[model samples]
Target: MKTNEEKKALVKQQYSELALSADELKGKCCCGTKPMSPAKKVFTIMSEDYSKLKGYEADADLGVGCGLPTEYAGIKEGDTVIDLGSGAGNDCFIARAETGESGRIIGIDFSPQMIERARKNATKRGYTNVVFIEGDIEEMPVPDNTADVVVSNCVLNLLPEKDKIFNEIYRVLKHGGHFCISDVVLNGMFPKEFTDNASMYAGCIASAIQKEDYLSEIKKANFEDIKIERTKTVVIPDDVLKEHLDEETIEKYKKGNVGIYSITVTGKRP
Candidate 1:
């Protein structure tokens, strides 16, 4: 079994590769080795459509998000927003549209390649207020009470220690400030074999914890007015499950009450 640090390192390396290949695989989901046949959109189940949105930059969209956090973020013009795991500045750009020129947007990601790509995208759009910083979300470099709002999309589940990340999020936001996050959470635990795979961790599967535990962490952090904004069921097809599990494990999964869900949640930092 990989230690906490080892799991973090593995996630960083895989996401770095994803950022390096972002341009080539612009609209492709990073779930499987090969794209599932069109009949089965299993791998693409987590991603949402962003083409119609204003301030939508195709170059910045990596097609890895499970939900649209910005949609429920309640951002206002001239608010300072911080985006964790910004990934080529997808959510940052969308937040920019809402924040307008007076607002500031800071994107933090551990992947160097993702930071570089995000910075380039900001420059291309001539947005001086949008900035990308390379840093671990668990131990962000930003100051206390620095953000008016915090937003993240499909990134937190990749880490082994979610409590620390939530505490950090709380520390960074002002008293009335809130956060909106879209992330993957499981109804129950997967098999040990499935959870132990490093690639599955990066693909936002193995690293996910149960929904109840996930919500508990938020409450433990002293956040108030917590609410689940939206949820979408994600069904990984049988063919994709076969890649990781044997026939018996697959059958158990099918018969069990296990489910994967993309949930958008919000909470205020009191």
Candidate 2:
């Protein structure tokens, strides 16, 4: 078994490769055979409604979110929004449209490649209201109490320091500012072996925290009026599993032991 440090390092390596590879970017496993197209399809379906917003189409092809944060953020004209883990800026593009030319949107992500992709997409779409920055979500470089709305999509579970992320989110948002995030959540504890699996963790499956624990952490960070606005089960297709996992692992994943789950969680900093 790999040490925790080793596991983290391996997962990081896997995702670093994923960021640049078109196949991996399309949600395929690193092995280059098994299709994760179903996962990508699900994300696309959920975010289809946001395509109507300006600048959204340029970023949509790069999106890997399970739900739309803009819908729940209640964004309006003149609002300043911050998107953590902005990925390819799908949410940023949508938020920019909602805020219009008079408003602004700042998108931050740790991955330099993703930041580059987002910036290129923004330029291609002539989005003057949106800016992409390279930074970690746990220690955001933005000014304190500056954002009217903060959003993240299917990205929080990748963090090892989740408490710090929530704290940073609270610190950056204005009083009464809202946090709307869509992320994967675990219904129950994952076995140690599974939790420690590098491929699984990098795939956004193994790192999920239980629903109650997720809420408790946000509350501890002092976010109030917390609520789960939506939940959806992401079914991993049988064919994909056969291509990716051995028989033993396939059985483990089938019995509700492992699957993608999505939840839209909303809270306010007060």
Candidate 3:
């Protein structure tokens, strides 16, 4: 088994490559990373539609998000918002629409390639208030009590030590400040091979924990008034399953109690 640092490095490397080719490959990728064979196109099962949202930028949309956290974020004008794993600034630009010109949006991402691409996108749009910083979410370089709100999209499950990450989120927000995050969670077990695959881990499937555990971590971070805003059952295509499991196992998995869900949850630091 890989160590925590090794897993982090693998995730970082995958995302770095994704930052370069996501736009060009478009629908060919799954969960924003893990490029499939060109002959077999992999549809994105995690991303929500962002094309119709206000302040939507086509170049900024990498088709990686599992849900639209901004839709349920309850952001107000002039509020400072921090987006964790803000890839290419998709959610940042959308939050900017709600926060308006007076508000500040800080996007923290560990991938330098993603940070550079996000900065370029911001510059292209002439947005001075939206800034992308390269840093680990588990140990953010931001100051305490620095944000009015926090938002993340399908990025937390990719990292180990989710408890530490949630604690960091709590530390960054002002008292009574809230957070909305969209992430993936599992309802049942997966085959050992599925969990062992590096590509599957970065694709946001194998790494996902139980839904109950995900919520427990949020509460453990001292967040209050936690609620699940939305939940959708994610259907992984059979072809994708074929990459990991044989026909018999796939058939059993399809008939079994297994379920993958994309959930958007909200909580506050109090």
lDDT of 2 by residue, 1-270 (tens): 666446445545654554576435553456767655643332333333455656566434454577877888888899999998887777888888789899989999877777887788889878888999988787899989989999998778876667989999999999989999998888755446556655566666667788788888899999999999988886655654454456776666566455457899999988
Angstrom error of the Cα, residue 48, model 2: value is: 6.2
Instruction: Indicate which candidate wins on lDDT.
Output: 3
- In order, how many clashes per candidate? 0, 0, 0
- Per residue, candidate 1 scores C-alpha lDDT tens digits across 1-270 of 789999989888888977786555543445746644432232244789988887899999877899989999999999999999998998999999999999999999999999999999999889999999999999999999999999999999999999999999999999999999999999976767777755567788778999999999999999999999999998876666776567877777777778889999999997
TM-score for all predictions?
0.92, 0.84, 0.93
After TM-score superposition, the amount by which residue 266's alpha carbon in candidate 2 deviates from its true location, in angstroms, is 0.6
Is 2 or 3 the stronger prediction by TM-score?
A: 3
Candidates in order have lDDT scores of 0.87, 0.75, 0.88
lDDT score, candidate 1: 0.87
| lDDT (Cα, 0-100) at 235 in candidate 1 | 80
- Which residue pairs of candidate 3 clash? none
lDDT of 3 by residue, 141-186 (tens): 9999999999999899999889999999999999989999999999
